[model samples]
Target: MVAGGFSELGEEGRMLEAQVKARINGTGTRVIGPNTVGVLFPHSALNTALTPNDRIYYPGKGSVAFISQSGALGLLVMDSITEFGMGVSGFVNIGNRADVTEVEVLSMFMDDPNTRSIVLYLESISDGATFFSKAMEASLTKPVVMLKTGRSEESSRAASFHTGAMATDDRVLDGVLRQAGVICAYDEVELLDYGKVLAYQSPPSGDRIAVITTAGGVGVVTTDLLTTAHDGVRLRMAAFSPEEKAELRKYALPIASVNNPIDLTADGSSEAYA
Candidate 1:
């Protein structure tokens, strides 16, 4: 169902895309895309992605469902997911969305029992009101993460050329997504990182964090990073209780520090980690 050379090609292509959309408007069958790579559902063994199976590794069964606007970018993310050992439940590349939109797909994922988290890579949104409502509703039960491009004028122009899309204002988009409780990712790395954490772990009860590292310098940097305010949330390093420090000292080497950073020195081992 996914074919390129549609609206992105200009006026003629736009007309062609409109005709295709009209033909499928009333049909019960939902179309994923007219110019897209297609969908992949690992649990069902369904793979309609245009990217060859051998080109990139598909992750194992996971609770994260990823939806992307760019097929190539989706493939790149899939490759990264494999490298990071992150699993995915489904992937959909809805390029030049002729019939199906992100809102519709998001609603389906929201009701999917297998999906615990949703990640999206979008150059543009088709219907702002529908997207906001759907995303807001879905975020109430599951984490909805998004990496929206086109923040810069140059990038916006490029997105327009690539997908025939008009980019929304970056500030407005940020405010709207934030109000909807959608976690916004700045890049691909953040997108997957957020997805993995949400899929595998429960939400933290508090913003307090404890860093355990073999490298002292890494611990310091991590403490600084955690303590910094992100959005409106700030994380502080948790202070260790005397009993906790005593327990740590039993496992740590004589020279190891039992403070909040809990630096176990370079000789730290699996037993120490445990």
Candidate 2:
């Protein structure tokens, strides 16, 4: 049940929102949002988004549960889910959060057997302590990745205007989230990418990774990216032994280099990949 013109507009809007919240104070029913597009459980075919069906198609069933504070951004992400090759178990648009907040939705997702990972696009946090505690608990079982915007002073002011949210210090927020075991994403793409990877793959037992590519430059870039520290996880490129290189050369082209990346050159074939 999402209705805009609440809280973000002015005093009248805030009063209206307060009244609405008061009405649901002691009810059996729980509301997700008063100013939101609403929730979507894709696996169950339950979609309450205000966005028209024609504007965004279902991204198919997945194990990632997404919660967003911005309705428009949620819709945009939903529209791109298919392109991103990630699916959704559930999606929540927690706009204004007059009644329900991100903490409640996060608890639901954490207990949901269908959800393997959680992603969030948050403009602000309503309750910092509760959010940190809930996120820490949830991340113990599944990955909780967040894309928190409004880092800049100008952007924070803009966010206040957009959703009536107060901005916290970015550095402190980042440290708090990290300490809570939440993976912070810099942008929407990183959020989706993290979700996609977590959805499709098991967590690596070790930080050592091997890269194999036909293009040398691509392998180099990937190696560079992996070796960098992310959320305190430092990845190291796995080194191939001489014997390992010799065995790989039997399958690779003569010109192929048998380094850590194992570049197979332009003439690399399917057998080389195998």
Candidate 3:
């Protein structure tokens, strides 16, 4: 693996990158990058990230495997998720993607027993068909969440320089990913939230969900996110029986809304929830 190089430099650097690729050809050796932060395996205490351990936070050992095209984003996510107490099985930063590709890593992690789910942050996909195929296969066995950038012209151009990645129309890509049983997150917060849920919790067996909140507005927003299709998948509000509603009303304040989304108002207390 070439830890770092000049691929981010522009024209001359790209030429040098080509030379490196040629040097590795027919050697039965696959190279990670001419420019990369490399990989991290927390379980084995192996960290190839460019930053020092004291300078950056790494995730603990668990089941989620993360793959990111941007090294900085990977580092930030590593800090945020680990800080939030989410454990990770491995992390890969595929900067420039000279030889080792996301598809290859997806295949590897999907088969790893320690990996209960996979999360990816990508600016572009090198091979859409193969990626979708492998992603679908992985989703069937476990969970897969993707956060892809380059949805707009400006962002697409930025991605070109960041990783030499060619952008695809996100509208079409979103539909394809949904068909592959992959969940798409628009930002880092959603990426981490979705990954944490998938890693620690089993998927819901029913189409039912109930939002309980002390704040009415939060309950409304939660209901909206749940009912109006979260990332192309619709959620249903579970129906409550008359007896159940009466039981809930007995505990909540008179002003509390005891509907599908049980809003306890701002005056809600622990006993109300109990």
Candidate 4:
């Protein structure tokens, strides 16, 4: 079995034997990659890696499967998600997707009993039509949240620097992702936040958003944000109810404009969360 990226030759062979020997009495079985972080079936306790192996700190296994194109980035996400208290059923770093493409991994997760959600961080979409078809099918069964990069001109150049991938059109990709019901994260923080939100929070039944802020100025900004048109989607604010307007005045300045962004005039507290 190949360990890492290199196969065992004469000198490397001796080193490999010694390392494997010290770990498991020289009886370590066939491993896929020596330079790879082991895959974990958190529910099954099946760790297929040649590294110091254990799952002492992994969160409770659940229905989410995280599939990443870059193994290193995938590991980073794993560490972050663990700290954030998100649970996972399986993790696959489909390097180059050489043998295992996103479609295959997705299909497997679809049939997997434990997987409930799927998180994807892909730099490239290899086969657009195929990915969309499979993603649509999987999403019908479970939600798929994606943090895709390399869409913009600058980001495309940056992606090539990190991973020799030929960047494609970001606009078309964005359309495809939206049409497929895949949520896109604009930044890394948003990526994790949205991932955690989608993983734990219930999907909004409707797009009606009520913003409660601490100041009139903040409310104004929020109103602008909701009204500002970007891409094809425009935020359509629902008219506030008479009771909702009254609630806004309780915490807002006497002169504060009572609108969609109901500012509490710097008097709101954690209790406002409802």
Candidate 5:
């Protein structure tokens, strides 16, 4: 890792070379910090970091390539996905983004046969127009879920501790992402949850959902959540046929009420989901 950051490397180019070299070298085999966090190509079974860590658990080889600007988050995501029982084909932590970027990663993943989805947690955009254009191109082939941090002045203040600079340009980033069809997550948990959902499910064939609940109050709250205006989400309740409504009565409580947010009342069970 030390060898990767040497001054023989001018500042950017040479340093990147050193990092790549350390990755290529075996005796220097276990090093991962010459310039950036090394990548994981799961199909190859390649683990060459200096510490020889195997923290990422990707199973069955799926098509999502996770790219993050923060190395630590990259590692954490690997662990999270493993816990969630999902598989990943590639992982990249493009620190400094001096050599690789979200645009480049998206471009590469779009072409990779194994990648059907892409997840990103970005801090800032070095080139907004170029990134958005590339992202749009990639999205035509696969879904991209992005969680952009450092949105407010306060968050930017926190960002300075890591990269020593404020990184928020909230409106511009939001506009660019939405125009390109990139789904944004608001926080880490949301990032994982929504990304997982998109990874497994196809985009809505239509924008209608049928909510069946036993609790009326819970159903009301859920309807409010879905109907409340938001930037990227607009959900509509699906209508059921009379026959479907009649079938619902078999499982509804004696006085159950059925509507857009259908209250299955007291008869719903785990088997319903199964």
Candidate 6:
């Protein structure tokens, strides 16, 4: 992997990058990045990360494989994973995508037996159709979580300057992700959280949920969250029909509100909930 920086946006750097690629064109050598920190495999103890090893913390071997378009953010994510007491099977920084691409690496991780979930932070896609195709197939076997940046025009320009990546229309991206059956995380934390949760837990069969709480205010807040749309996806509160409520009332406490957000009250026994 070429862990060195190349200013693809500049003329001289582009020329140099071309020369580097030509040197190894037919040698069967694959390059990861010109602006990337490179790849890391915690299980195999192989690290070609460009970041200083002394200052950065690395995650242990685990089921998640993280792919990032940003080199520095990739390091920060590794540090954050260690802090969160989580580990990754592998971490790859697909910088500039001169040769290797996000979808290609994603396909590689899909074949890896150790990877249960795939998480990616992307600013742009080099090949959108292939990415969606590969992601759709991978999602059928394991979870695929993405945290995509460059939503706004300003950020789109910023990303182009940063990685020389072309941005896609956000509206189109949303529809594509849904068709691909890939989960979208709003931020960095959500990306990791969704990855961890998906790795450890089975996905719910449906969006219907029942919130049970001793505190009415907490239940109300949770209900709002369940009903509210986030990143184009919304949860549905499981409405308790009159018949279901009547049945629950038979066993619940006298003052319990047998509604969707079931308020058992503080006095309600644990047995009543059961």
Best by TM-score: 6
- Give per-model CA RMSD: 2.8, 2.5, 2.5, 7.5, 5.6, 2.3
**Which residue pairs collide in model 4, if any?**
3-34, 4-33, 4-34, 4-35, 63-115, 63-116, 214-266, 251-264
| Alpha carbon lDDT of each predicted model | 0.88, 0.87, 0.87, 0.66, 0.68, 0.87
Off by over 4 Å in 2: 10-12, 84-86, 229-234, 241-243
- Weakest 10 consecutive residues of candidate 1 by summed lDDT: 225-234
Which candidate, 1 or 3, would have the higher TM-score against the true structure? 3
lDDT of 6 by residue, 1-274 (tens): 5544465476666676788789989999988888888889988899888778689888888999999999899889898999999999899999888788999999999999989999999999999999999999999998999999999999999998888778799989988997999988889988998889888886688999998887799898888866887643478988888999999899778888889799889987888878
For candidate 3, write residues 1-274 as lDDT tens digits: 5455456567777788788788989999887765678789988998888888889878889899999988888989999988998889999988888789999999999999899989999999989999999999999888899999999999999988877788799899989998998988889999998899999786777778887899888988887887776443478898899999999999999999899799999899998887
Q: Model 2, 1-274: lDDT tens per residue?
A: 5778877787888898888878888886677776789888978989778978777786778999999999989988888887877689999999988878999999999999999999999989999999999999999889999999999999998888888888989999999998998988888878898888887775676778888898999988888777877543458888888898889989998888899877999899998798
Error of 3 at 2 (Å): 4.9
In model 5, the worst 10-residue window by lDDT is 1-10
Q: Candidate 1, overall lDDT?
A: 0.88
TM-scores, one per candidate: 0.85, 0.88, 0.89, 0.72, 0.77, 0.90
| Model 4 C-alpha lDDT per residue in residues 208-261, reported as the tens digit of each score | 677777777777677676666662124566789899889766755686556777
Kindly list the per-residue Cα lDDT of model 1 for residues 61-175, writing each as its tens digit.
8899999988889989988998998878899998888888889889989999999999999999999999999999999899999999999999999988887778799999989
Deviation in Å, model 2, residue 58 alpha carbon: 2.6
Better of 2 and 5 by TM-score: 2
What ranges in model 3 sit over 4 Å off?
Answer: 1-14, 229-233, 243-255, 265-274
